[model samples]
Target: MKIFKITGEFFLAVLKRTAFSFLDLMKIIVPVYTMMTILSYTPVIKFLADWLKPAMKIFGLPGESALALILGNFINLYAAIGVMPLLHLTPWQTTTIALMLLTSHSQLLETSVFFKLKTRAIFLLILRLSVAIMVGLLLALR
Candidate 1:
């Protein structure tokens, strides 16, 4: 009887934590997805797609991918992921973006930390971006 009660309590706690986590994720993903959907109906997405196409192609990604990269670098991976489903990217493209973003995500926050350390923040920023581009290119070629 005691074991059953403990097990039930544990499961209740797990359920509560899961629900909270889901809500937190939805808070970020929902807004970004909504905004991306709205932009799709306007020329803004098209304009950005066209503007970024050439540069993005070098990494084997669509122009729409630039939004994800920007959001991932400046905001967080959740924001980038929120834009991904709308992009209809290929598996390879998804993999490449995941790798690139994982390599150099959260630049603004991390750059400030680097500055506080009295390091050459600009150099580190350039290095991370360069590495991200290189990783994207390498995955794209494969």
Candidate 2:
């Protein structure tokens, strides 16, 4: 029947589209996953995490979260995105932490890319953390 033929074609088309979408997702995800794995083992991550502890303490985030925050701040937002699977943060905690990071993510890189005005990167970093911690504290209180 023509109706049956049309339905079969539609089903096959949907299946083909789904498979291609999954393949595209894998292509994008694989490199980021690999990079995150390599970055996890790097001493730089450890050092930055340690460097951020006292400040991160104000928001009650673990040092490992600080590593993600710092990477997100200085590198690219994808840095934080890539690290999330490796982190042990709960969904709520992850959202809170990620929001904080995104509030000032990759300022230096982004500023340079946009050719914006120059300012002390450290000053901005501290201000961003202060705001993030305040928001985090408010969320915790709620």
Candidate 3:
């Protein structure tokens, strides 16, 4: 079918792109990314996560989610996507958590990917989190 062909082509394109993109990313970002990774592993991440635990709990997620949020912020969504399977979130929980993660997902990296309206990304991301929190809190109340 046409749909199948299109899907197949899309996946092939993605594979090619991912392979090329990896090299490009490694060339440009690997050094900085490595340094950041080292910093992340050196207790700073845990310290910040601990500090933010209370605020994170308000959204029905625990501290681990905070780590995921931070990971998603600096690194990328790949890590968070891996963590999602382990969490085994329910449908409502998924929506709430997805909203929360998507709110500020990958601000450091992808923000520049937006050529125009760069500042709006942060504002929109915050708005997303707020709306997600309000909706999630209301649902939890009921």
Quote each prediction's TM-score.
Answer: 0.84, 0.56, 0.50
Q: How high a TM-score does candidate 2 get? A: 0.56
Predictions in order: lDDT: 0.93, 0.71, 0.63
Global fold similarity of model 3 (TM-score): 0.50
**Candidate 3 residue-wise lDDT, 1-142, digit = tens:** 8999899899999999999977765553555455546755688756766888788667666554665565656666555654554444667666666666665567666666652655676666566556756765665553
Location of the lowest summed lDDT over 10 successive residues in candidate 1: 21-30
RMSD, one per candidate, in order: 2.5, 6.5, 6.3
Count of residue pairs whose backbone atoms collide, per candidate: 0, 0, 0
Candidate 1 residue-wise lDDT, 24-113, digit = tens:
878888999999999999999999999999999999999989999999999888889899999999998999999999989889899999
Least accurate 10 contiguous residues by lDDT in model 3: 79-88
Model 1: colliding residue pairs: none
